[model samples]
Target: MTLEQNPALAPVSDLPGPQAWRDIGVVCPFDMALDHELWRWMPDGVNLIFTRTPYYDQPVGLDMAEEISDHGEIQDAVRSVMAISPAVVAYACTSGSFVHGVQGARNLSKAMVSAGAPAAVTTSEGLLMALDALGVTRVAVATPYLAELTDRLTSFLEQGGKSVVSHEGLGLDRDIWKVPYATTCELIRQADRPDAEVIFVSCTNLPTYDLIARMEQELGKPVITANQVTAWGALRLMGREAVGPHQALLQATKG
Candidate 1:
């Protein structure tokens, strides 16, 4: 009955075969409807499993932010994700991750690890890491959140060492997934400043995977989106090279 003598309990080999595949788990908010967008950019042989944490469809405001960041719900989601035994786990929500600030975000990731995730990440933490990797100091932000949430996002970035040269929001709380890509493009344009180094589009529910390269081309700078950074960070945690569509952040993998 020793594990050494039991093939069933043996560790998987590094040998390349059918059983060799990477699994990335995501803890998404219940209100989010755009997890498919992340799948569009996932590389081959990598599987993404998502567990939706409790979230109200009500407006994305302070109360909603507070509710989504509940340690209990996050822990529950982490436990659910752990059941899949993924290589890494990510809390793929922007406002929820940053609502309690940077320290809170770290604690969220730690919670995931304590819940049995091999590694952990959060959307806000991913955004900051992506920005740093791109060596971007000044940024423009566009979000589907209301003014207060937008302000909180800016503050989070600012406190993390990035300057929010410009920021704008649609003041939206409902049906964020319904927001057209054209509208997000315009919001980024409006938020773009003459000296902004990059554009960041917030909200995991927002459709952004397709717009990243095009927006970067038009704006002549990197365009980082919530889902993009979340995926990138999780892939990094798994020690895999960042792959997917042509986005500036994905291209800049060093550091």
Candidate 2:
């Protein structure tokens, strides 16, 4: 007998709830391994549908960033999730958005919109929004990128009219998700300075959900991360708040 005809099976119309109250489409890099981290910022009653750029054998670098950020690749990724009708689509890769500088990041957002996303945001754009929301200028940065890649981020920040007071990097080309909390904490410590107003932990794949509040307490300054800001920006486009209890960026958005 067909499953639909089985007496033990419930009818499709008997399902209890809608797929979600709201949905956000996310386009991530092929090597993104920490999907749970992105979900941590999603509020209840909302859902995240994800897609990825085509896999590349090259390690994470300027070349890799360029490849993933290609308008064609991003447009295709965005199209894959258009069926969900998400309120907004986010390109959740920092280097990909920022590697080509300020205009490049904006182009990435436009690409998503052109591909049928109602709205779009990129991690680099989210970082800028987080900074503007907090009304701070001097920033410190921590990353798991090589010196060259780190410099590109600095340039991107400067192009957006923010000064990079100090920065540190782990110089890894791949497996940024594998960096431990202690090591990440140390990197933040090394990157922080009295002159800097906020500390930004770059890279969505590098976990930071559990560390934002603790690090803010330890450093006596607000801390922001890639995934945190990406979710925040995307949710904000939909007139919703991201779900972070003590995250400084989320708290700033509260009425």
Candidate 3:
């Protein structure tokens, strides 16, 4: 009758031991699609839980009032999915995540916990963690957000003890669909700073798969994009890593 009465509904333990398959929840915009780039080099068996805000119209500015308005809808979707009891959940908007500054980051995590997934919240904000993990302080950035949101990101990173040495923003707001793959690649080429140790391609909506390898090579540095860091932090919270070359960090822990 209920899942509790059916073995198939329960978690199946693997041979020789128990390996948990945890879910990582993402709350983002509905019109946007999941780019496999998140797990590009990730291992296997990890899962994703995505919830998106129903669409609405507004200016592209990054004002606090506008930011709060957008997040209201996005967070509503997040709360609904969080009711599902995910292991960890994060609000996936880079611009929205940091709109309130560092406090916003803490608040988003707190919100996820309140919604019932008490593990952690990973954001484009979490990329800061990845940068810190990689020992990057001055970095390059790329984004699909408008100038307003990009400005907030600059402030957010500066507050984090890092500096955005150089950056680029495409100035798109409601429709992230128009950010062409070639344009995103060009943004990387143009925004990348020669002296920077890390390049942060800073949005989740723009597909990043095509440029990751090239960006690493050109900059001669480790590049951590938003989705990459988002995936890394979420998978780590889930206690599993998908197996693939994209998992540059988690591969060492697979033993």
Q: How close is candidate 3 to the true structure, as a TM-score?
A: 0.80
Candidates 1 and 3, the one with greater lDDT: 1
Superposed by TM-score, candidate 1 places the C-alpha of residue 63 at a distance from the truth, in angstroms, of 0.9
**What RMSD does each model have against the real structure?**
6.8, 4.1, 6.2
Which of 1 and 2 is ahead in lDDT?
A: 2
**Off by more than 4 A, model 2:** 1-16
Quote the positional error of residue 101 for candidate 2 in Å: 0.6
**Candidate 3: residue 151 Cα off by (Å):** 1.0
Which is the winner by TM-score between candidate 2 and candidate 3?
Answer: 2
Considering TM-score, which of the candidate structures 1 and 2 is the better prediction for this target? 2
Please report, as a residue range, the 10-residue window in candidate 1 with the lowest summed lDDT. 10-19
Model 1 regions lying over 4 Å from their true place: 1-19, 55-57
lDDT of 3 by residue, 112-212 (tens): 56656667664755777777777669988777777878888888888888988998988776656557778887887788777876778876766765566
Cα lDDT tens digits, model 1, 3-101, are 768756655774335656789999888887987887876777789999987747667788888888888888888888777789999999999999888
Per-candidate Cα lDDT values, in order, are 0.87, 0.93, 0.67
Give the number of colliding residue pairs in candidate 1: 0
